[model samples]
Target: MSAPNVTKSNLNFTELPFNVSDSNMSVTESLLYDDEAQEFDNEEKTWMFGAPLLLVFGTISNILIIIVLMRKKFRKSSWGLYLTTLAVCDTLLLYMFSLDSWLQIVFKVWISDETVAGCKVYRFVSYFLVHFVAWILVAVSCERIVFIYFPMKAKIVCRRRTACIVLGSIAFILTGVNAHIFWTFSLTEYDGFYYCDLVDNIAELMGPQFVIIFLWLDLSIASLVPFILMITCNITIIARLIQSDRQRRAATSDGAQKSSTTSIAIMLVSTATMFLILTLPVAICMVLSLNDEFTSTGNNMDNLYFAKRIAEFVQQINSVLNFWLYCLTGKAFRTELKAMLCCGRFSRTPGVSNAYVTRSTSATTQVEHKPKDVKTNGQDNTVKKAQDDTKL
Candidate 1:
């Protein structure tokens, strides 16, 4: 039987778990009736089994990232600051959301239900971190574009101090924008289990239509605008990197330079592409699900729920995947990680230096300098001699 339309006063429908259907019976009644069945559906079972494992590993990975980025060699780079901040944000996102989800699914307990103040803190922190992370990515993309297009000016424009200031401003502005959540969320108890939900009083005062409008506005700020910014900046950065590669090839015959540039370009482009791929679905689903018309259709509700759960899963994946992306694609990061893991023993080993020299010599042989033909054999011989000496 189709569930009855439970009173909206008892729970905020939007805050309910995606799998939870709107039924005539209250949330408490539904839970009691389905206690055994609620053990978890296939999707939820997967999340429960896998998410905690990822969370634990992700937490360690982010901590390692933070530690590596804080080192003297990396801390001076503008990208390091953004990456460190991103790691911090990812860590927070996991603890606040992924851990909370595990608890809710396994124990049927909501951390935000502990106290009124806890509700406010949970809602505010969750929303704030979501926006903060998005904007930080936008900042990273913009910084990369500048570093690629204006290498000389980037030293001045993308300083560590500048990154700090930008991050601070982002935190301040986003916190101000999302501060409303602190007051808008409250604990609602049903059948002795408390759920964190939107305050009914505010909903009534604001009206349903107005609330929908506000949600659209929030969605725009939190996802749409940042997504656009990230895509635009990264696209431009990629274009510039390609152009720079061509110019560098024409100007120099250094194979090491080419390899370095290509690796960095791949890293930046891949990171931006991954962000767009993982986040865009969630943004689209959020926008569609927030629309009253879309949710009103009975047949579409199940599809919507599936989409929402998939979106949530992908979003959490995004938070934990950055460390792997960097480690896989970044040569310097791998070196640093190796050193850190070995407690500097790997770095101190003589083989590391010998390997560097071998690679450098090999790289020189791989790329030959193209020279204009000279009428004088002497001049040609002189240039050839110089090239030979430089290679040696």
Candidate 2:
């Protein structure tokens, strides 16, 4: 297929894989840019294959994450607050962004474009949820910073109440930041279908700067700032972990402090690592696309667009990733999930069996009468603990 002689003036931003409202194409460009013969096999396969898998698996997995994080043990921890909110946000994002995009691309049925309010609301919610997903992980990292560096203060500082306050404040500010989309996205009917785009006098409403700043600002928030912050925070976290490990090795006793903080640190690092790996490619693609919009002829438009679409498919996969990521990296998450599935019965040790053993021993020792053979001393307790371990 021959490439179209397209330019930014004639380009339809809405005609990406997700929102191919081709009616937005102008007559001059339409004459050169024949959509009937061109096919995006790779792009189509990407959305087709990714959308369902993400919807089904991602939705279920995020629910499992919510359930696991919401357990009583996590209720008081800031980790629970941040992670649970993230799960909820990811769930909404998968449905709103991934599902809607899939439906529009594959079925040519988009409810959002059917009405003006639907269009604006959909735009607002989808963008808002995306900002939430990225920033919530930042919040998680912040929580870990408190836990690992300020352990003494972590209990007081990283509580559920503080997490809730921080998240709520962020949510409120992000809502205001993205609220412009709700006002700017108006449905314009061309031929028979509606296209979501800025209003006709968008310049008057948002000023000439809207065109200059809107997409770039979005890129900054959704990708740039986050990339820098997560990288810096995680590097600090890695350095701190290295220092702690050195101290632990030099000491004769096991580092109780290290043990307590290690689980959350592992979780934070894994989450941040996967988040960067999955999200950065798309961010790069977006940068390319935005740059190409001004610099390219229609020749490589398809290629640049295809790259972004593929990146988006990966982003969808990220939405459903928490469950698998957690199960792989988090012992407590796996233990809780197993417990939830099996009605308080844990599938392994290091969780339920250890707790059960401790409880049973305590009950025996606290009976109305003490056994003459039992000695209430630290040495005997150590011996008894060893015996219990040997029995297990």
Query: If scored against the real structure, what TM-score would every candidate get?
Result: 0.76, 0.78
- Cα-based RMSD of candidate 2: 8.8
Q: Backbone clashes per model, in order?
A: 3, 0
- Cα displacement (angstroms), candidate 2, residue 236, comes to 0.6
Q: Kindly list the per-residue Cα lDDT of model 1 for residues 38-81, writing each as its tens digit.
A: 42264467668877986998898899889977864476766778
lDDT of 2 by residue, 140-248 (tens): 8877776667655665676678888999988999998987877777886554555666776778998987865777777787888887888888998889877767766
Of the candidates shown, which would achieve the greatest lDDT relative to the real structure?
2
Clashing residue pairs found in predicted model 2? none
CA lDDT scores, all candidates in order:
0.67, 0.68
Worst 10 residues of 2 by lDDT: 1-10
Q: Where is model 1 poorest over a 10-residue stretch in terms of lDDT?
A: 1-10
